[model samples]
Target: MPAVTVEDLTVLPRLARPGLGDQPRPVWQVTNAPSGYEGEGFPVRRAFAGIDLSHLDPFIMMDQMGEVNYAPGEPKGTPWHPHRGFETVTYIIDGTFDHQDSHGGGGTITNGDTQWMTAGAGILHIEAPPEWLVQKGGLFHGIQLWVNLPRDAKLEAPRYQDLRSGTVALATTYDAGALVRVIAGSVDGHQGPGSTHTPMALVHATVEPGARLELPWEVEYNALGYVLNGSGTVGADDRPVRTGQATLFGPGDYLTYAADPVQDGRAVTLDVIIVGGRPIREPIAWAGPFVMNTKDEVLTAYEDYQRGRFGHIPV
Candidate 1:
């Protein structure tokens, strides 16, 4: 397994880079972003939101919002917006967010809760800190990932899976130093409750210092790890990753992550999310909130929103 050191948190021992048939091990691909800002009205890094839909198939965009310690009166959030032809998965780590859509769906996703919305046909929604949170002001950290829909399911219908914190599936590693919350996929034999438009796994893992976690994944799926907190090494290339960085893994049957051992009394843990899915070979035409297969379809989505087809939130 690849390893990371506790001192400087750099990659330590890297195991053999294996071939596909060599019992499946993840090869470190690329490390990008010292981290930057993108549309959360806060600091965030754009994960898979790119033009190459075929490459990051079944997944479109991922935004990691603040693990920010917001000062007492300065919280930011987005207003009502329209989306079509895809799904948006929102995972909250800390703080509160009240979500509402025109389809008569609205709920709150507090810490560890998930809101998986399939904007199959089209829908308008609002996501912002709740009245209580906005009034009191505190830390707010979360992510919203866009999962692409195939051409057939593009306009099926809009749906929402507002999962509570306790209801989400949890799995423990054999040694018990780690806990994984399966949001949309299986991890360590436990499966998430969220449904999917694509075959994928979205898991948030927290591993204690000195623990080496090896996760098995389908060989045909594409996977990557995002370091949300602390530091660790990822994959057989044993790429060292600190907070706010994302590492894409090459083909492998299992991915390895190791948190640095404790130097002083305090130990460095690893908090990250692993996303993997079977590639959906399809064309993509995306414009802001609307993701479709053609430019004309994109235009139609905009026109529909402009024409008030997507319902509105009551004032």
Candidate 2:
């Protein structure tokens, strides 16, 4: 396969929508609001809502939330909830999240930690503030991604992987002043931690101003780059993107990204969530927090939750 370059990536401009004026107070409060994205009781807010990147595929939704001030001793966290027919990947950049599920799975995810939860069949889980985090007010940040499961794997057993920073592989492109942290899949010949059930790639990249980097296309999957901080340009041919937005690329095997030397003079951190899989173009019967192939399946999940079939706490 040919290596993709910065020039091959297309940039799709993201239309700016009216944002809540004056950055929401206590960012966490706004995100954790009862009626926000995800659903009620998912305490850690400050999430940037994202849509399905590809037309139909293994991935469904992605949310990046962070750069928020967290007060010490605050009882802020996600309550119990159930998920089916999908997986949840949580990457923590700041603070800590204590995760527990009914499958007898539990762990504390700190900065530079990754929690990959495969909610096959069914699972009930809760992420809450650790005692230490609650007492020590500081900055808390992270990203939560939702990946759809293939039909055959939908009813498989649930699994979880906790990866520390050192385990994940990193590929650096010095010429382009860019470095990519591979969370899954191969990047620049480097493989990442956390085994993926499906063929998918998730990378976190940082590019210095005026630098350029190219990504090869061997895996046919939908790709997108989300700007976390600073501004830059991405795309190929007629496509180009600006900062503070996500640029969805077109069909191709490779794509390139370049930072504007004049505007992005310094290094800019970009959180790129690249996901693609053989499209599962199946009907989606989603209800509040449960997503299944049919409405009956959704109902079954809820019924199980009510019956405490998933259990009250981690098994």
Candidate 3:
């Protein structure tokens, strides 16, 4: 939960209040994420399960990895794998992860760091806990989001971006009751450090008890909100939402979130991640690790990967 913090939020820039005639987004749907095990048995909540792909457009899926505290020798990670035709954005909130890819992109990202990998064309990669972390375990919590590239850019080139926590743009609500970390795209006039191939915005916000956060949003992008901790209400209509829940917002010029005045002992504030992107609207043929515009293209990716065209594991 400690991605980034500031003791004096009042010192940060404040987001402008919604102007007259600005339409507040209405709640379209609220879904409870189903928990399941992922890569080497780590727990995860599938954030986009049961949602239509049309609503998620340029974004494919998201996973909220463990808020679990692992004892020594209990932590686990993914095995080497290949991906094609998309990008993976992994943001670490409370732990460390090591990433290595065949394209020579590798790094260690700790709390509040991000690894953005574009598997444009195709690539082989692996993510795991550092050896030291595996021997002396600790808290691990993070998010992995899949962003789809346009059909034309899907095979351009592979690339990577390591965005440190310090680089994220920070802003607060007008009353300083919430802290907003802009990880990608622009929020109002505040821009995050992430360089995206698609038009999108990603934000992590912590709202104080009883505070309301109203954010202006892009009219062309579809908006979604996922709660990571505490209870809150989404939209101006106040539909109740809580941990492990995802909300889809309807058309509007702005979005609203309000934290309840009372929270359980374990949570002091409501933490949520909001994301939006312009719809690609192209046919998607997604198989294990490949997302393409057509089934034939996905088959080609499989064949290319099998032929070792995605590259080999580093010696």
The C-alpha stretches of model 1 lying farther than 4 A from their native spots are 1-22, 34-40, 49-52, 263-268
lDDT of 2 at 232: 50
| Model 2 poorest 10 in a row by lDDT | 24-33
Please say which candidate is ahead in TM-score: 1 or 3: 3
Better candidate by TM-score, 2 or 3: 3
Best by lDDT: 3
What does candidate 3's lDDT look like per residue over 241-268, in tens digits? 9999999999999999999999986888
Q: Which lDDT tens digits does candidate 1 get at residues 1-315?
A: 011113322222222233457554555455554457644576777754333456567888788887777776677778788999999999888888788889889898878888889998899998888777767888888888889998999997898888877766666555555666677776545678888877899888777788877777767888877777777777765667766667677786678788877522222468888888988788899889999999999999999999998887677
Candidate 1, lDDT over the whole model: 0.75
Estimate the Cα RMSD of every predicted model relative to the unseen true structure. Answer: 6.1, 10.3, 0.8
How many clashing residue pairs are found in candidate 1? Answer: 0
Residue 126 accuracy (lDDT) in model 2: 87
Off by over 4 Å in 3: none
Model with the higher lDDT, candidate 1 or 3: 3
Q: List the residue pairs that clash in candidate 3.
A: none
Give TM-scores for every candidate, taking all chains together and pairing residue i with residue i: 0.87, 0.78, 0.99
The 0-to-1 C-alpha lDDT of every candidate, in the order given, reads 0.75, 0.62, 0.94
Better candidate by TM-score, 1 or 2: 1
